[model samples]
Target: MGLLDSLEGMAASAMTNSGSDQAKVAGGLMQALQEHPEGVQAILNGFQNNGMAGHVEQWASGALQTATPEQVQTGLGGTGLIEATAEKAGVSPQMAQTILATVMPMVISHFAPNGQAPEQSQFSGLAGQLLQKFL
Candidate 1:
């Protein structure tokens, strides 16, 4: 199956297993990130360019600093990721921001372990692992 199809399946499975809004939003954000042309790099770059490189670095280094919703909105403001995630999760953009505040750090840490971003080829495997964790 295509990556999109796989992501849909994973998100559906997550919803089935947990039935939690957070899980659904996490899955949606994962889908959005995967579907982005730059994938997770765009997210990293967004934070980096928005003067939130410290936050991204902390997350990459396995620190557990939680992003505030406003921080999430600022870091991800123009990426269109938030809107995509909101649509996929069937949530309002504001709600997506709130959920993303909690989830984005984990996503970054998983995909960019030890302060390094994974190769694009590694994304599929890592995404599955991440989805499992969220579920």
Candidate 2:
């Protein structure tokens, strides 16, 4: 199946299984990021400012460190961000937080396979591809 189909399956499975929120968060986060012109930088800055730079390095190195929902919430700057994701994902903010805790690391690792964050322009293109998959 195509990546979009795969992601749709994943989302459906999440909703079906009734615990994993990965797909919901992935879609919401991607949509939220796509809505921002400076999204890549803003996210990177959030990681940096929230002292999750080392975790970002883990994502860059493909180690995939687990970030807590609280951590994701803090990294992204709390309720406003969570609410935005919830609105996009059609889930609660708490669910958005849970989903982001999983999805964010995967996304960072996918975009930074070489252990360095991509440039904003490169990330934008890649992020668009990711967003498309979930849509």
Candidate 3:
């Protein structure tokens, strides 16, 4: 299944958890990434800036890197992207942070299936593709 399908499935199952509106959360994430065409690089930069270089490399390795919610928050802290996403999705910032913590690793891994980041053009299309699939 594709990213949207996987997110939809996760959203359906996570409804019981407060602040787990899967679709909106996923949309918020895509929205954040879309708003920043350089988001993938920004995210990696954030990780490096926050002293998470190992985690950063692991993510690009197409391997799942388990990062804590607090770590995600810190990683993205400099960029108001999460707050922007929270506003866009009408969700709380904390919830947005939580959702990103859970989903960002998956996104990175999926997009870098060959264990390497895609070119700029390919990266730019990711959010649009996710949104299209979402619709």
lDDT of each: 0.85, 0.65, 0.64
For candidate 1, lDDT tens digit of each residue in 1-135? 877777678877876788788988888887887788877888888898999999998998888778999999889999999999999888899999998898888988999876567876777678888889878
Candidate 2 per-residue C-alpha lDDT over 1-135 given as tens digits, one digit per residue, 9 for 90 to 100: 543444444444444544335556666665566455555556666777888888878876888768898888777884255677688668898888887787777777767666456764565456556544444
Models ranked on TM-score: 1, 2, 3
lDDT of 3 by residue, 1-135 (tens): 554455344343333333445456666665565566565667767777888867767876767766787988888888877887787667899888887786677666655554455665675355545444334
Candidate 1, RMSD to the unseen true structure: 1.4
Per-candidate TM equals 0.92, 0.69, 0.69
Q: Which numbered prediction scores highest in TM-score against the true structure?
A: 1
Clashes of 2: 0
Clashing pairs in 1: none
Global CA lDDT computed for model 1: 0.85
Q: After best superposition, candidate 2 residue 56: deviation in angstroms? A: 0.7
TM-score of 3: 0.69
Candidate 1 worst ten-residue window by lDDT:
113-122
